[model samples]
Target: MNVITDNLGMLGQGLVTTLTIAFIGYACALVVGTVIAIFRVSPIPPLRALGAAWVTVACNIPTLCLMILAAFAAPRAGVPLSLFAAAVTAIVFSASGFVCETVRSGINSVSKGQIEAARALGMPFGLIIGAVVLPQALARTIQPLVNIFISCLIGSSLAAAIGVPELTNVTQQLNLRYAQAVITFLTSGLTYLAIAFLATKLGGLLERRITGREAHA
Candidate 1:
């Protein structure tokens, strides 16, 4: 605490970087996950297989290893990214797999009758998916998405490994300077808890709103 005071501003700057990386990663993951989930449930065999393979590869890899591989290997392979982009990209690829699986379950929970009715009404494939399937799947996916978001929030701490200067990394700097690992970690934990709470509550509220609308309609 005492030893860290002079560097608190620097630490705050690092915290912002952490949040930015996490947000970018999660946003990208959300898009990738949605695409994967859609493909996983598609009628096309190759698309489904591709989605499955991606999930297996991404999900099975360790976080730090993925970060390192993405950060370092990419340059070696010729398609290079900065440390921050690499960390964010790795997080997106990894997190998207779990989110894809969770969303597939949500898609499954959408009743078959909805699809049948949509087809019977002459709704085109795209229309059926856009109008009927997605709404229901999204409603169900909300809770799980909230859960996924919370996990991402915690996992973002790992960005430190790639020199991203995220909250955990900044926390480490503070701990090193002040020799107050316990206090620094506790503060970081509380900040994460607050983010988790907000995510859960807001997602739940949105979920309920849509569900309520569906019920009334």
Candidate 2:
């Protein structure tokens, strides 16, 4: 209580930084993952292969390794990044693989008959995908995407290792300063748990609303 009360402002800033990293990272991951998913489903063999290779590499590498590479190696490779950018980049790179797979699964769940009908109507590949596939696929993917967002949020803690001073980093600092590791860590854990719970509940509500609308339509 003393530690928390004394450092409320610092904790608040840390929370904000954590949320910023998570949201930015997840948003970038969503865009990149969706593009890769499109590539995986593309008629062109090369695109599919490229998508496959990306998923294979990204999924196989550990997030911490990616963080190190982005934070340390990239600079040596002439691509410098701030700590925040490196953290977000690592999250985007690692999480995009799962996002791609999740979106690909959603795309596969779309009715084949509808796709066939669109093709029969002489719709171009892009048009058919944009009009007849993506909407339905994305709709089906809301819950899974929400889960990915939650994972991204939790994973942002790893940014602390790279000195981004996010929630976990601040908690560690407070623990050292106060010599109250248990209470400080517990407080941080509860904060994460609360955020995750709220996100889950909101995701469920959104899923239900979307499902109801689709049913009525």
Top candidate, metric lDDT: 2
TM agreement with the true structure for every prediction: 0.93, 0.98
| Pairs of residues at least 3 apart in sequence or in different chains that clash in candidate 1 | none
Off by over 4 Å in 2: none
Name the Cα RMSD for model 2: 0.8
Candidate 2: how many backbone clashes? 0
Query: Tens-digit lDDT track for model 1 on 139-207?
Result: 888888888777777878888887888888988888886788888888788888888899899998998
Each model's lDDT: 0.84, 0.92
RMSD of each: 1.6, 0.8
Candidate 1 at 114: error in angstroms? Answer: 1.6
Poorest lDDT segment (10 consecutive residues) of candidate 1: 1-10
| Candidate closest to the true structure, highest TM-score | 2
